[model samples]
Structures are given as structure tokens and as C-alpha cells.
Target: MNFYDFKFVFYLAISWCNLLEVDGITVAEQLKDVLMEGYDSSIRPVNNERDILIINISMNTMSVLTLDPAEETINFSSEFILQWKDEFLFWNKSDYNITWLKLKESFLWTPDTTVSTSIDTNYLIDASERYVSVKHDGTVRQSIYAVFTNLCDMNVDKFPYDQQTCMIKMGPWSYTTQEVTCIVGRDIAPNDTDFGDFHGNSEWDFEGIVSSVGETEDPDVNFTFSEVHFALTVKRRPQFYVWVLLIPTYIITVVCIFGLFTPTANHGLREERVNLGITTLLSSAVILQIVANAMPKTSELPLLGNFILAEIFVVAIGVLFAVLVLTLHQRAHTREWRPPAWMLWILRMTGSSKFLSRNITKIRHKSSTAERIHYTGEGAYLFKNLDESLQSVREYIQEEDRDYFRELTYVKFFDRLDFLLLFIFQVGNALVTLFLVKQ
Candidate 1:
């Protein structure tokens, strides 16, 4: 109970409290350990084997850059580059034919089942030889063609042609394997121009160069692509319409020409021939329109239409010629441009008229005593002079009337003139079209 005793008791109490605290700590620690062991034994750590490298990229937008056409050769490139959200493609030049990795699909009306079937160039190629040339050696560029469903109704000639939806296929050489993907871009419309004799239903076209940024069917892969160059050359696929129309038109045209030979003296013959010519011209024009409906319009002319028009012109000229000839024949009969007295005198002395009289006499003097003899010398000499004089008169009259005849020959002259004009125009057209269409 003294101070030391008190201190010792206090220390003992403190020690007891400390021991109790220690005991509590020990119990708590043991509980913690047991819980930790149970927790560790009951559940295992998760193993994540997710590949974070591969990602899917989508091209949903496209933009076309302005073209610089000052260069004799113009180049069009795209600003749309490939992008993946999570990870980028690990591409290599060796991993693929990067220089030619552009995507392209075979365009066949009917897919060839044979591996080695003679096929026209699947892709258009510009080369020195056009018809028989088939090779993979060519420059690459971006080019496209839009093929519509009903081309007959498409307003190809409308100014600033409205951009139309078309099936687009982009790729490489006829033999190269390609893979490409592009975002839907702005629609390309045709320019407005009034192409004379040219139908406005032209095929749509586009040209550019596409660079490959990644490989298809392979994720996280890249390849270098040669600029896939293209020159859109859309040929009008004649659905045999031009030919079908041409056959009937040509037949009718021939029939009209036959009308020209019909004798005008025949009842209503001249009127019928003129009517037939007009009808044939109109029919040919309609057929031409049908052809134009299937073709594109440009600031140019159509060769086939020109040819048909030329034919119509020829027929019209023939009709005019027939009318002129008939008028002249009637005038000659009325004017009495008969043989002159001097001409008759020379003819009689030559016995040419006498011989005619004798022939007539033979017919009229049937069963009568008439001596007939084939004389020469004087008779032959006179006959020759008479025939010569007759030929001279015919030539003189024709020459004297040459101017009037020429005036009347308007129909024939027009026929020839139309041929010349159309020929010159067509040649110019061919040159111009070649230049305009050249990519």
C-alpha cells in the first residue's frame, strides 16, 4: 500500500491491461490470418488473355480533293486515310503487293466458269495497241464508271448533269488480285451541254488514283499500294437497239429510193414517191431518236445519225431530180425544139429517112411486090453523116441548156453537198471527241 506498493500495483494493472490488449490483438490477428487463408484458398486469380492489338477499322466517309488539270497529266488523290479506334495496323511492304493493293472486282455479265476462257480485258488499259493488246504493263490511276439500270431515261445531256447512283468497281490489271474499300462520297453529276445530234443519255464516268493503306481479310496489317490510276471510259452498251432500228430504217430507205424510179406518168406515182420519201425520212429520224435515247449527249454529233440524215437527203434529192426531169420533158414537148430544116435536108439526102420510110412501107405493104436490097457506098456514107449530125444537135442542146439544167439539178447537187458536209463534220467530230474524251 505504500508508494512503491501503489506504483507496483499500478504497473501490475498496466501490465495486466497490456496483456489483455495483447491477447485481444493476438485473437484479432489470428482471425485475420484465418480469414485471409480461407479467402486465398477459396478463390483463384483471374487470367486475362485478351489480344489488344487487333482492331476493326471502318471507312464511312469520303472526300474528293480539288484536281489540278494544268499538268498535261493530272493526278487526283484522296484525303481519306484508314484509321482504327484502338490499335493501328502493323503493315509492311513485303507482306503484300502494297504497290498494287487497291481493291477491284471482276465485272462480268456472266462469270466465266472456265479458268482459261478468252476474256476481253476485265479492266481498261491504255496502250499503244488497243484491240489485240493484253498485258499487265500499264500506269495505275483512280478512275470509275457509273452504270445505271435504265439508261434510256437518264438525262445525260442535261446541263450540270445530276449526280446519279451507280455501281462502282475499283481495282488493277486484268490479272492482278486487288482489295479495296471506300467511303461513299459526293455524287458526280454530268455537265450540261447541248450536243447536236448527240443523245443526252451518256454513261457516267470518274477518274482518280487510289492508294492502299491496309490489307483486307487480315487484321492489323498494312501494304504499300501503287497509285491505282483509272480513266473512266464508259462505252454505250448498244442493246442491239441501234442495229434493230437500223435494219428497218435501211429497208425503208431503199424502198423510198425505188420510188424514185417509178414513172411519174403513172397515176399518182409522183405524189406517192414524194410521200414515200417524206415518210422514210421521218421514220429514219424516229429510229435515230430511239438510238439517241440509249446514248450519251455531248457537245458533239452522232455518226450514225449523220449517216441516216445523209441517206434521207439523198432520197429527197432523187425526188427533186425526178420532178425536174419530168418538168423539162414536158417543156420540150410544148416548145417544139424539133429538128431544123437543114438537119432534115441532110438527113433525107443521107437516106436515113428513106430507110425509115422503107421499113414502115414493109409493114404497110404486106403481100405487095417490094424489092429489098442491102446497099452500101453512097447509102452508108449518107447514113453516117446523118447520125453524126443528130449526135451533134443533142450535144449542142444539152450544152446550151447546161445552166438551166444545173439549176434544175438542185436535188442531185444537194445529195452530193450533204455527203461532203457530213463527211467533213464527222472527221472533225472524231478528232474533237478523241481529244475531249482523252483522260
Candidate 2:
């Protein structure tokens, strides 16, 4: 009875012990599984380092989500809870602030070391959640550029949506910055309400900035970070050339056109006045040439350039008119009297020098006046044909003296009116050209 009872009790106890051991093993395995999962959620293996929390954020299609150095890049596999900062704390600055942006997105972080991840250019920024920071002495700059077929056709409305998201192209995927600033402005941020005067140069269609900041020269500050945005727009036509070249050319042409008013009937006239007009016209032409040289050659003429050429032509025609007027005055004066007054003023204005004075004196007195003076010999002459001759001579002398007074008055009037008309024409031409050119 003792041996049998002892064996049965031992077997029962051993079986009970085995069952308890199995239950204990199962509990231990379950605890180990739970601990593994907890380790994964709380600790991240990064760059051979362990135990790091992760942060995740979502942004808009063209939004920037800058990460703090302490948090680094986001881990794609981690679960994140929604987080937000007090909007008033950031937006309550004395200067204008954009508070509405705070309500749209959230950012998540957990003191996690960052993992490297590839970002696709086609990927839109998730605007629903984003991370932000306000570090002591922190500064951020953003620049945007719109790439268009031509800058000349571009308008203010066609500019990029966000300066922070817009980028200027440099290389295949690079860009250079046109501006840098901590605060957002029309030139820096799309959200800026104030637009500075922007002149578009069609040649500079592609614009952008560096994505990362260069190292600061100061030794105290060891790290530098920067982010840039870029954009592109298509254009319809070229406009830069017209504003830069044509406008100035047109103005100069108007000045050249004023040379036409110099009258040809003046005894005071000289060749130099005409020459001066020619020189100015030539100079304007040279300027036109320079403008042409700067631009790409095309069959179409610039509107301003055409106007300049027309002005030069007009000057040439005026020169011809002056020559013809002088010829007419000379022929008419031979049969009649003095040239017109306007012609005289022009001659005086154009040829006040010795050369013109000498030439005019020589031409005007070359024939009848000088010959008559030479023959007259400063003495009155009497002719006789007996009684009739004597009586007729006295009557003839009296009538000649009387007619001389009337001829003088008529000649003077003609000279004055001609002079006035010539002057008015010259001045009028100048003013009209100026007005047209300005327009």
C-alpha cells in the first residue's frame, strides 16, 4: 500500500507541476511580445542609434514644411497624434500676420532622430498637418520665380502663387535667388499684400534661389539652413524691347524734327545750320543702330526706330526746301527787292559768323547794285534832247524819287511776313513732333 500510494501521488504532483510550467511559459511569451511592440513604438533605430520618437506633418500642394534640427526628417511608418500651437502667440505681432494659416494644418513630433527619405517633385505637400518652430535668433528667407516663354508678355496676375513655393530655374533642377529677407513681402512671399514696382525683362524668364544656405562666416554659429521655392509661367509675346528701346528712340526723333524750320530766304543763312541738323539725325541713327545691335535681329522694325528714320528724312527734305527758297529769293530779288524777313532771321540765326556774312555780302551785291553804284560816280547826271529833253528830264526826276518811297514800303512788308511764317513753321514743327514722340 505504501509503494503504490507513493507512486500515484508522485505522478499526480509531477503532472500538476508540468501543467503549471506550461501556463507560466505561455504568460512569459505574451509579455515578451507586448514588450517588443512597446519598444518599437517608443524607440527608433536611426543611424545605428536606438530609442527615438518620430514626428509627422502634412502640407499643401505647394507648401513648405521645415523640420527642426532636433527632430530631423519624418518617419513614414509611425503613428502621430494631432498637435497645435496657440495661434495668438504667433500671429499677435504688432506687424501684420497671417493667422488663418494656423487653423488649416497640424504638426507631430516626438524627439525622434530623422531617417533619410526620398521626396518626389510631383508629390504635393500635405497641408492638413505641418510642423513649425520659433527658435531664438531664427531667420528664414523665401524667393519665388515664374518661368515663362517670354517675360515681356507676363503680367502681374500671372505671377507665382507662393514665393515660398515658386522657384527660379538655374540648372536642370536648380535656381538662384532674386531676394532674401526674414519678413514676407511682395518680392519674397506670395501672401504679401504690397507689391513693389516690378519690371519684367523677357530675357529673364527663369528665376529661383538656393535651397540650402551657405555656411556662415562667423565661427560662433556653426550651422546654417535654408529652403527655397520656385514657380514658372508661360507667356504670349515679347514686351521688354518696346519699353527699353522704342520709347527712348521716339523721343529723340521728335527733337531731330525741329531742325526743319530754318528758312532759306535769309541773307544771314549758312551751311552749318543744315549740317548741325544732319549731325543730330546721324547721331539718332547711331543710337538706333546701338539699340538694334542689342536686340535679336528681325525683319520687323521697332516703332521708335521707324520714327527716328522718318525724322531724319524730314530734316533732309527741309534742307532741300531751304536750298530752293534761297534760289527763288535770289531770282525774285533781282527783278524786285529784299528777301523775306523770316528768311533774314534764319540767315542771321544760322550764319552769324564771318564766313556767312562775307558770302551773303558778296552774293547780294555782285551785279546790279555794285555796278549801278560804280557807274553813278556819286554825281547827278543830266541828259539833253533840246527843249523837250530839258522839260522831260525835270518831270522824270521828280517821278523817280516819288516811286522809290512806295517800292521800299512794299519790299519791307513782304520780307516781314515771309520771316514770320518761316519762324512759325519751324517752331510749330518742333512742338508737334515733341508731343507725338512723348505719346
Candidate 3:
């Protein structure tokens, strides 16, 4: 009776201890259930209406994908870390035997902020899994990876040699600044040392990044909203355009000027020069079109546009100069017509006076010598018909000299105008180029 009773009592004591242990485990499980029962994921973790939901944001640019001026957008990949405190998620780490817990984003509350400049067609190129971490202090941190195409207002007024400032702006879509405020994360310098890792774009060189906070009033929402801006400063690498567009345009312009020197007397040469000028003009127009297509459509003209226009003007002047020379040459073929006195005076003023005077003196001397010789050979016969015959000879010689001088003057005039126009064109072209290209 003593042995049986002792064994039964020990077995009963063990059963009671097991039941208590099970109850304790159930109580521990109910703690988490109790904590989550009334929790609302949609509500901010703040006790008072005056309390602000402060979200700390940090961004690391993975790469610059594309910068399209014509489309007025810049595509880039980035890693964003958002951190905030959720007072409700707080718990004693010792009680749960857990320092931190990883949860899906849907299981926690997050700021309603979104990228404002994201394009509509493809807002995000690629995204990583959304993750949330809850610390013992109730601080919830989320890490997100996405490729964003952001709107970039381009100032192409200095295009090709332009430095652009593109921005990535994020703010609460519905919350006002009074309800939620954004601050830069603890890592204030995002992507500070990771610039070398960027590889998507070859046309632009990343200059630097700038961060700032801005506030604006939205009438549609009837609230003042706060925004965190990440400004990316970049510069275009113009070597591609310099070789492909500028150098060729410059060559065509120079060749057009050279065409002015082609002889106008030969029909083939004159046509060749004209054709060359026209071809250069057309080539410059094509280059301008190409540049225009590459830049955003804007009201103001760019520096390259001005340069192309100047080149076109210079080439056009060359064509006009050639046409004028040809017209003068054809006019010179008319033997009966003499240039107007004002026209001759202009030629003399333009450095043809010395040659004209020399030719005139030679003709006068020859006429005097002929008259003197005729007078000496037939003195008696010359005296009888002196007035009439001498008058006829004098008029004939003057007409012959005038004809010779007129033709000579026409040729000299054409040469002087050609050189003067060429010199002016060269000087003007150089000045315009220095002003536009060098600057």
C-alpha cells in the first residue's frame, strides 16, 4: 500500500507541473495577439493631433539610365531607405527574446510619400522586395529599390556645352506638412563615394548631388506640403558633337568662302562655285536640323543655333558675291556703253586711280606724238585741211582711248570689289565664330 501510493502521488505531481507549463506557454502567445488585436495599419503612430509623423529619407543613386532632352526626362536607378518611429510597435526585447523583427511592408505602417516627378508610362523600371524592420525602440526602417524616370526641365540655351540640373522630388501625396514632415536620413551624404559605380549613361558626366527641403502650398489639396529634393548636377560631354556636327559645319562654311575665288569668266567654273555655295548652305541646314532634333523644343534659340545661322549668312554672302562678279563681267562685254561717272569715281576711290591715270597719260602722249609727226611730214597740205582733218583724227583717237580705258576699268573694278568683299567676309566670319564658338 505504501509503495503504490508513493508512485501514484509522484505521477500526479508531474502531471500538474506539465499543465502549468502549457498554460504559461499559452499566456506568452496571447501577449503578441493582444498587442496586435486593436492595431490599425492605416493610422499614424502618434498619440496627439499636434504630433508630427517625421520620416527620415536617404537615397543612393545606382546609375544614371538616360537623359533625353527631347523628352524632357531623366531616367535613373536608386536605393531609398526610409525610417520612422512607430510608437505602437514598441516592445520589451527581453520579454520576446528578440532584438529585431523583419516584416513585410503590408504588416506595418509607412509614409504616404511618393516621387512627384515620376513619368506616367513607366513609373518604375525595376523594384526590389519591400522590407520593413522593427527595432526594440519601435523604429521602423524600410529599404526600397526602384528605377525612376523623373521630369527634368532643360535649359538648352547653351546646348551641347550645357550643364543640367535634374531633380528627384518626393513628398506625401495626401498629407499636409502639419501632419507629416520629411527630414534627411542619418546618412546625409547619399551616393557620395559611389559615383564611379554609375554606368548607364555615356553622354552625360555626373557632376555632383545636392539635397534640400522645400515647402509649397497646394490649392487643390488645400494644404501646404513639404518636399525633399535630390538635385543631380550633370554636364554634357560635347566631344561627340564637336567632331560630328561642329567640325563638319565649319568645314562647309570655309569651303563656301573659298568658292568665291573661282573664276567667273568660265561658265563651268562659275556654276561649280555656285553649286558649292548651295551645297554648303544645305549641309549647314542639315546640321542645324540634327542639332535641333537632339535638343528640347524651346522658344529661345541655342548658341549652336546662332552659330549655324551665322555660317549660313556667310555662305549666302559668298553666293551673292559670285553672282555680282558674273554680272559685272557680262556688263563689261558691252563695248558701246561707258560706266557712269559716279561708278568710275567709286572704282578710283577703291585703289584703281593710279592705274587709270597711268593708262590715260600713255594714250595722251601717243596722240600728241602722232599729230606732231603728221604735221611735220605735210606742212603745206596739213595747213589747207588742218581744222576739219585734225578734228576728225582727234575725235577718232579719243573714242579709241575711251573704249580701252572703259574695258580696263571694268576689269579693275570687278577685281577690287571681289577682294574687298572676300576680306570683309573673312573678318566677319572670324569675329562671329570667336563670339559664338569660343564663348
Candidate 4:
């Protein structure tokens, strides 16, 4: 045959072979036949008596809905991926191009521990369809998307500045470690891409997540079962409490301090100062009640609780100081009462002459000198008569002495006490605020 004739023959043979077409359809049919042979959907795909089924588990947290410290529960949405090998679904990819099948159409068996241990079943909020993927080696991976409200033991001792660890536990319902094992799947960490889409929770911020696997002993069944645990770490966002509860309480407590400096000359002003102190104290109590209502009842006190207690103590001191000042004023006006000698010395040493009313100290000094002279019988008598004139002059001297004492007594003591208490409060409040905030 010539070159042209040989080329024609080759082309004809290639076309004939293409017409026969013995690849995809025939291979798929043969694979299906082999896969169906003696395959039982109800039985687990364990090859021999010693074979054990292993399920790889992983999760991708989608969003955090709520974290209720009072309820000791966390609500979140996540996608759980579980992968296992099924010998019945095995097929050579080179022979057949079928890489996966829909889970509804497949006859694969699944584990009983499909749901999380802490899942709230009554409110079943999962809204995802069951989807599966297959590998050439017969490994099947199924994904389940669920919204879970799970029980978590929260330690809220630091509340509002606290970090909490909440866990999602998954384990087999009836299978022991001997028959099946749950392992952490490869590449099973939280997806950072999903974090940007996280539902904004006003009270908490999502920190991160950790995954681990271990076996737990069931005493009732006398068996150890494998479980997969995922821990989600979240931090409490404290700005809300700082502004609403803490700042207001602190401001009210500090305002109570000013009541101590109110003027004692006017009884009405003194009464107003006392009333202001009482009002501030009641405001602090109301704030404390609000904080208490927000938190769960527990024996251990939270940091916020400690701060509220300190605020209450400070305000109570202010109220007591106000009452003491009022009592001193009333006593000075109604009756004569001398301060102890030691107290007088301390008051004189710490007293600021600049803060006192002009000429008040000079008047006090002159009064003191005149009283000493009168008691020593050094002052001249106004009249010569022994009984009648002496008695009349003595009555006038006593009336002047009483008026002088009333003018100097309460006002002087109150000024000194106000300065001392202000210093104490400023230092004490600073320390308390710093300690509580750092904690």
C-alpha cells in the first residue's frame, strides 16, 4: 500500500475504535456492581473482628449569639465535620470519575453520637442540610451545621473583666473505645475568615478556640469511650459596666465628700449638706442593687461587688461625718462643751489660719487671755459695793463669755475636721479605686 492508503487505513481504524467507546459507562457499571456486592447498610464497615471504626471530628464556629453568665450557658452556631472510612463505598477514581455522592442517596452507616453532649434538644435550631464528600479510598466526610445553646460552668468572680472557657463535647452514645474512637480532625481549627462575621455580643468578645480529644470512663457501662472536646475562650467586655454601674457609683461617693465642707454657720445649710449625704448614700445602694441583679447569686464576691462595697463604705462615712458636724453645731448653740485637751492641741497644730474667718483667731486668743485674768481676780471691779454691784457685773461677764464660746466652738472644730477628713478620703479613695481596677 502507498503512504496515502496507509494514512487512510489508520484514520479509519481510529474512527472505528471511537465508535466502540468502552471506557466511562462500562467502568461505572462494573464499579457499581462491585460496591453493591454483599453490602449491608445497617452493619458498620469493619473488615475483621479486630477492626475498629474511627471518626475524625472538627468544627468551624460561625457566630456567638449570647453568653449568659447567670444561666451558665452559651449560645453559638457552628459547623461540625465528621469523617470516617466506609469500605462499601470504595471505588477507583481512575476507573470511574465519581468522587462523591449525596448522603441521602448513599447507604452509609453513621455513628450514634451525632449530636453534641451539651446540646439543647428542646429548641432544635439547626438549619443546615446533611452533606457528604467521598474520596477514592472510601473516606466519607459529613458536615452538620447547628446552633447550640450549651451548658457551661462559668467562674464569674472577676465579672465584666473576666475570661471564660466554654466547651462543646461530642462523644458516642453507646460505643466504647474498643469498637469506635473519635479523634480531632486535621485542619480543624477555627476559621479566621468567619470571625469578621461574628454576631456582635454586647457583653462578650470572642478570643479564640482550642480542640482536644480524650477517652472518658463510664462507670455504669464499665467502658471507656472516646470524646472530642472543643473549648471556646471569650472575654467579658467591661466598658458597659464601667460607664453604667462603676463610674456613676464612684461619682456619687465622691460628691458625698463635699458635704463635709458645707458651712456650719447656717443651720439650714448644715441640714442641706446632711440631706445631700443621705441622698448620695441611697444612690450608691441603688447602684449596688442593679449590679447584684445583673449577676448570679453566689457565695464568692466579684470584683465589681467588692468595688460597690467600698463605695458604700465611703458614702456611709460621709453620712456619719455629716451627722457628727450637725451634732457639734447643735451642741455649741444649745450648751457649752469643751473639746479634750489633746484634741484641742491637734486642732491648733493642723489648723490653717488662712482658711479661718478674718480676725477670728485673734478674737479667740483675746478671749482666752481675758478668761484667765477674770478667773485670777486680776480684773478691776466696776462698782465698790461688795454684794449688789459685784453680782450685777458678774452676770454681765457670764453673758459675754457664753456668747464668745458659742461663736468659736462648732465652727472652729468643723473647719479642722473637714480638712482632716478630706485628706483621708482623697487618699483612701485613690487606693481603693486603683486596687479594684487593677484586679
Predicted structure with the largest TM-score when compared to the true one: 4
Model 2 per-residue lDDT tens digits across residues 19-86: 64574664333333432342332322232333221212211112122211112221111111212222
lDDT of 3 by residue, 1-439 (tens): 6999999999997886576457466433444464567888888888787899898877754577789999999988877778888888777876665666776677566787788888742325232346578787889887666777889999988777888988878878878889899887432333456433433368887776677787778788578988888887778888898888777877778767866753233423565677788888888888889888888879877888878888999898789878766765675564333445576665555454433342332323233654454433547675747655666688678867766765676666666565666677878888888888876
In candidate 3, what residue range of length 10 has the lowest lDDT sum? Answer: 358-367
- Using all chains and alpha carbons, the TM-scores for the candidates as numbered come to 0.31, 0.33, 0.73, 0.77
Query: 323-387, model 4: which lDDT tens digit per residue?
Result: 78678767656654445557657777334332222222222222344344332244345332343
- How would you encode candidate 1's per-residue C-alpha lDDT over 191-220 as one tens digit per residue? 312211111232323322222222223234
lDDT of each: 0.35, 0.35, 0.72, 0.69
Least accurate stretch of 10 residues (summed lDDT) in model 1? 108-117
Highest-scoring model, lDDT: 3
Candidate 3 has which clashing residue pairs, if any? none
Pairs that collide, model 4: none
Candidate 1, which segments miss by more than 4 Å at Cα? 1-234, 237-239, 263-268, 292-297, 337-439
Worst 10 residues of 2 by lDDT: 172-181
TM-score of decoy 2: 0.33
RMSD of 2: 21.0
Which of 2 and 4 is the better model by TM-score?
4
**lDDT score, residue 140, model 2?**
12
